[model samples]
Target: MKLAIVGGGSTYTPELIDGFARLRDILPIGEIALIDPAEQRLELIAGLARRILARQGSPARVTTSTSVTSGVDGADAVLLQLRIGGQSARHRDETWPLECGCVGQETVGAGGLAKALRTVPVVLDIAEQVRASNPAAWLIDFTNPVGIVTRALQDAGHRAIGLCNVAIGFQRKFAAHLGVEPERIRLEHVGLNHLTWERGVTLLDEPDGESGREVLPELLDRFGERVAQDVRMPLTLLESLGVVPSYYLRYYYQHDAVVRELGARPSRAEEVAALERQLLALYANPSLNTKPELLAQRGGAFYSEAAVQLIAALLGTDGRSRTQVVTTRNDGILPQLPDAAVIEAPATVDAKGVRPLPQRPLPPLFAGLVAHVASYEELAVRAAVAGGRARVFDALLAHPLIGQLDLADQLTDRLIAHNHGYLSWA
Candidate 1:
């Protein structure tokens, strides 16, 4: 099958290429078209992609293009991993919010709102081009603020499904702790993208004579310190919640502390900017065909596996039928949330498309936070599509992380001032 990566110039492309090489048996990729406006990065990434495929003895051809229409034409699937304004813009997103005494994060709170406003319009334009090129092709989004972006695509009548590696990363970690293969571990991963909790971890292939048991608590107890450290949450909090929260939750649960920490250090965007420079230098090395070890520090662990598995399931390329966690429309899977809201949960995937699995109502603790964030996301989408200063102000006001009216007003003005070039209506 022909697959195109929309932001193929990203440093993360090598990790994805490694997955395509390793999982060739399941997906059988024939061609990979790298689409990006950054020609230098595109050439570097495409070379590494070709080298990785060659090392695997796979015959998939690697091509590069700057035109979305040309690159995605006749492709079976398109993957969106683009950044609107690159790391420089992200640096602004991660820093400016601190002046308002809020956590400076790229995927939540004020910074996340900035990203959504800038990204949604560009993604929608790309989706339109993809539809013009090949209506049958699926758009797999791996962008930040995925829930909002995915809803925008689906609402605009695009065939899209959002993908994140958080669940898979958790599954792999839990599997390692249990001394079992990752496939045997099934996580009851629920909530909006980036904001989720692991309520249960069940063994899919329980050995004979072994009773079915929920392993999340045991896993937490045995490795609570390490888990807490990884997520930057207190061990006591995890124990109290009785559920392992995603690392992103740290921004919400410890907003003030996180703001202090952020203020003391360089923005994550700055760190990544330095890292990307080194990564590009490494990519330029002709001898370097395999994914570099430094790439792991860049995060998105297990992203390739997640993307490949999701695509294989969607295209019915993988012979086995199974359910996998993905980001898609609620469709009653979350009765408490709006039907048009996007959620990340386990869903059965096949040629017919994705079907979210039924989930029991979340407990009040989790439900309240999710509903609060969902409300903000709904308004964020509206502001992104029908841009206006008022819409943006309302979105910030609605966010639980930035709920105060005065702070919202200040943040709204700051966001527009910093991102006016990208926001046409502003």
Candidate 2:
């Protein structure tokens, strides 16, 4: 069996590669290929992967190419973790739209839509290749605007899964609140990526209804303010529904009433600047190329796939055990909505491949928001690929925040004029 990691030379690639190398023993199978256009990044990462494999007492064949098709053909799986602007370009993508008075945040609002228009085609093209070349390969997505991109790929009939560290990562953060280890927790993650909240977690056998009755009440009463105070957490989903969540809680907190009541806001300007400075510094680091050991210390040397451990679970490596993933539609897994809804839900993994979790209805607000954004993203994908400004305008207007503002037409025009070549139809 073979695995292909498209955009294999990214900063995060080393992490994924290292993660995969770490899990390779359980997997104990075949070659892992890296697909990337930049020879420099690919060479550096390949060197590192071999070194990692050697250290792990295993010899994993590492190969790469500039061509997407060559990298993906006949591969058993493709794990995608692509960035549109690379590290440096993200600053402009994040800051420019905010400067224009658009939602200004990354991966959710105006900025996300703009980024989506630029990315959909590349992702779509690659998906088409993967489907045609190796129809059985699972497409694991770690792409941003994940809900939007994942939805589009499935609508076009590609085999794919969206992975967010959010589910596990969030579980860990909130575990701090509950006083437990994340690995020991079992939870149901619902809603869109990045926006997802834990509807439920069972730890120490915290019976569903029991924890629902006890822990949430305690969280809301005791540490609710503490959780919301960070400005990176999204406690609104928790408070609105009375369940705790993980990942990026602070920003969501600002979006919620609790923050307003407390007169709190995440320092957006400062936050954006700090992120920009960090990314800039990362690009400027010289040891990034010549010194693998030192660069490894920086944590960028671990080129990796999105779900090696999960893949190990599917392959049943080292008894890692299978898991349930909430992603895309295969059948009537979700009862009410079209299998086409691209709803996130629990799934099972095995040596054969990754399969969808049977779907359940999300909370009304969460469902509606995910549906609306996904629908508009599809519309925007069509517009971007076909060069239709009106459709693009309508797509932007259809977004929750943009739709609410009534500035779609003007904002559309301004952004089109400003972004120019960047937004095709605009």
Tens digit of per-residue lDDT, candidate 1, span 1-426: 899999999999999999999999989999999999999889999999999999988889999999999999989999999889999889999999999998888889999999999999999999999998799999999998888899999999999999999999988988888898888788899999989999888875553122456788889889999888877799999999999999999888888999999999999999999999999999999998899999998989999998888889888896755678999999888888989989999998887899999998999999999999999999999999999999999999999988999999999999999999999987
Model 2: lDDT of residue 122: 83
**Number of the predicted model whose lDDT against the real structure is largest:** 1
Worst 10 residues of 1 by lDDT: 204-213
Give all TM-scores, in the order shown.
0.98, 0.78
Pick the TM-score winner: 1
Off by over 4 Å in 1: 206-212
- Against the unseen true structure, what C-alpha lDDT does each candidate score? 0.91, 0.62
Counted clashes in each candidate structure: 0, 27
Per-residue lDDT tens digits for candidate 2, residues 63-179, read 998898889988877887776656434444445545445545547556666667777778988998988788877888878777677877877878777776656554555578888
TM-score (C-alpha) between model 2 and the true structure: 0.78
